[model samples]
Target: MGAGPVYGQEVVLTAEVDLAEIVRSKYDFDVAGHYSRPGIFQLTVDESPRSVVARKA
Candidate 1:
């Protein structure tokens, strides 16, 4: 992946899972299918010059 610092605007992360067997199987909880579960991903972003505001003392 190319690091386009000057060109990059924003970054986002998304996750999803398959709910086929998980819906029918009785595996305690709904977790029968092996897929990418929706989870929270933290990403550090550098704000643009226009978006960043300087605090005046």
Candidate 2:
């Protein structure tokens, strides 16, 4: 086996939610994997209270 190099990338996302609903609710996100030419790492999502962060690492 051989080692590989790594590339860096940054992404940002946002969404709105209804704060008048139940204290807590389960919400689903329709996210899928990516298929493309090899380069570095893979795509990922970083979720937060006010926004979401995505990146291709």
Candidate with the greatest TM-score versus the true structure: 2
TM-score (all chains, Cα) for each model: 0.20, 0.20
lDDT of 2 by residue, 1-57 (tens): 223343474434444666754344323322332234335446777675663677779
Stretches of model 1 off by over 4 angstroms after superposition: 1-10, 24-26, 29-57
State the weakest 10-residue window (summed lDDT) of model 1: 32-41
Model 1: pairs clashing at backbone N, Cα or C within 3 Å? none
Clashes of 1: 0
Predictions: Cα RMSD each: 13.4, 19.8
lDDT of 2 at 28: 34
